[model samples]
Target: MSAAPLTLTVATPLRVWFDAVEIVSLRAEDASGSFGIRPGHADCVTLLAPSVVRWTCTDGTTRYCAVDGGVLLVSRGVRISIACREAISGDSLESLEAGVRSRHAEEDDAARRARVEQLQLHARAVRQMLRYLRPHPGGGADGPDGPGIGANPR
Candidate 1:
């Protein structure tokens, strides 16, 4: 039996899009750690972190996206909606690399380092999410199996 397909959509401020052209990635915090969702996926919602989001198209093409933080919703029909602060797609690799380098440089400062660390942590979380969302890259959802809701219980 195959899993349902997931429709993933990423949205951010229009201004950001105008400034940086790219699409962000999404991931699910499943009981198996993290898993990527493409077009066909089960219906459920999960919490997301500040990390890079990765997605593999049906053609076997993989894309990486960076996000600060956001929420992931998986509908019964396998549709995903991601609401995040900011997202950078693979197309913006240069800009994203610059941003990462800039953040890394800030690590030299004590105060700034802390802030940068926090941001980096968020970015890492987002990356993890992207990895999770990568189709079949990781094993089946292996974190905390549940209904895929409130994984990040507020």
Candidate 2:
């Protein structure tokens, strides 16, 4: 007897990319490496990496969806759901791969820029604080040579 056909759904927070599509099998990757799911696979949850989810349709055509890290849930041995931050679906694997790579690179650049900005802001705040704490050079009560925090009492 043949295995039952599986239903696949790929969704993002803003939209559903694939909804209740009937597929013969599904393949995806996580930190643990690549894995496949059939109709009667065990129910479980896995954390997907920033990679492609490939599946075969009942008509023997293969499709792909690239995700930006998400969660995959298998339920009732027939339903497979993927919830990702972002998703890009395509019929051409080559184009899909290129698009995913470009998206990932853009995100990496943005994150790097944000971190640099944060560090600059932190450095600026520290400089301002140090300037406020430094003793004035004019040699008075609050000067570097007087009787205050940074001065030697004589």
What TM-score against the true fold does each predicted structure earn?
0.46, 0.67
Worst 10 residues of 2 by lDDT: 139-148
Cα lDDT, all candidates: 0.58, 0.90
Q: 1-154 in candidate 2: lDDT tens per residue?
A: 8988999999998999999999999999999999999989999999999888999999999999998899999999999999999999888899898887787799999999999999999999998767656766754235343355655455
On a 0 to 1 TM-score scale, where does candidate 1 land against the true structure?
0.46
Tally clashes: model 1. Answer: 32
In candidate 2, position 101 carries an lDDT of 79
Candidate 2 structure lDDT: 0.90
Residue-by-residue lDDT tens digits, candidate 1, 1-154: 6454445667776523322122232444433467766444567676677777676544555556677767667665556677677766664557677776666566567687688889999999999876544434233432334322223333
Q: Residue 35, candidate 1: how far off, in angstroms? A: 2.5
List runs of model 2 lying over 4 Å from the truth.
101-154
lDDT of 1: 0.58
